[model samples]
Target: MTMQVRGSKLAARLTASMAALALLGTGAVALAQNWSTTVVASDNGHKVGNPKAKTKLVEFMSYTCSHCADFAREGDAAIKLAYLPKGDVSYEIRHLLRDPFDLTAALLTQCGDPKKFMGNHNAIILSQEDWFEKGRKTTRAQQARWQFGSNGARRQAIASDLGFYELMENRGYTRAQLDKCLIDEAKANALAEASQADVEKYGLTGTPSFVMNGALLDGVHNWAALRPVLDKQR
Candidate 1:
């Protein structure tokens, strides 16, 4: 009887060990999920989350728009944390360039590695005010430089004058690398052309528009309105 009792005790210990291992395996699987961190550059947009996700959320935003900035601050964190990790929802941000200043900033967002696009995009949009103030106070000389020069030169002028150089430098980009991206005429024209194409294709009339699962979400522009829709999606 004593030997049988000891065997039962050992079996209980072994069962507990297996349970703990199972729990650890579950945690490892969770940690291995890269849906949230995986970022990719699309045609004229930057996307994050599982490409195969059923619910595709596309945001048409402009760097120069305050409302777009507001959405970036309020909505991005939750979406990245909640929806993206589940691999059920994907978020893509498309630029709708409205002006030279907007196009200048958009070019900078596409600078450097494709993996860095999301961070660069968030940096520009969230810090829009800091640069907008500087843009407002720019000298006529600076404005002329932005408007009349070659595509790259004009954007380069905007970047220098609006404190964007300082902004991107904070993100660990050197001036030379950034200038190279700024001067890429092919990229500039592509982004601009894509922006116009999106405007017409989606009937986008303003900044901070939304398209979910191929249907444009009219009047659903801000976080408060969007959260409910996301919650109902899954």
Candidate 2:
């Protein structure tokens, strides 16, 4: 009986030791994974996740695009929660301006500190419907204000009259800071030129386009379709 009891106790100890070793091995594997993020050199795109990631994903999106907004809601979440954590994927967003409203939103998003760009971008995209409705309610005078001024002035007018300024304010921006961003002619022109250059280079058809590993992806429009491609690359 004593021998049997000792044998049982030894087996129990062996099982516990094996379990502890397994847990430690799992932790070591997790720790070995390398994850990191950085802003691109151009300062036009914000990148997140491992710089040396096997999969590089880029999105060309317009703020006023409903489809882009949809993708931002679902796709951005999945990237942050799944791919980024795995440390094998990196994601970037480049603006493809579609109109003045898009430019206004883009400028406002980039106007803030670089660290806040993604947060602002996500907020702007998520609140598109509400602000777009406000834009539609603009009076003829408001439209003229947005249409008549110089590029900087016009963009500022559109931002204020169409509620883009108000939207930023809701996001904790001050009027003075936004006014400075709104009237930055050089930045606005640069953004416009860059967007046009991307269009010509990529032969882009519309907003919410995707590029993976430097190849423009065709027919891969949503997270459901794109997720599998990312997995394969990983």
TM-score of every model?
Answer: 0.90, 0.82
Model 1: per-residue Cα lDDT over 1-56, one tens digit each: 99999999999999999999999999999878869888889889888999899999
- Among the numbered candidates, top TM-score falls to 1
Q: How far out, in Å, is residue 93 in model 1?
A: 0.8
Candidate 1 Cα errors over 4 Å, as ranges: 1-20, 23-27, 31-34
Q: Can you give the lDDT of residue 93 in candidate 2?
A: 87
| Model 1 deviation from the true structure expressed as Cα RMSD, one decimal place | 2.2
lDDT of 2: 0.82
The local lDDT score (0 to 100) that residue 137 gets in candidate 1 is 99
Report how far off residue 212 is in candidate 1 (Å). 0.6
Query: Candidates' lDDT values, in order?
Result: 0.91, 0.82
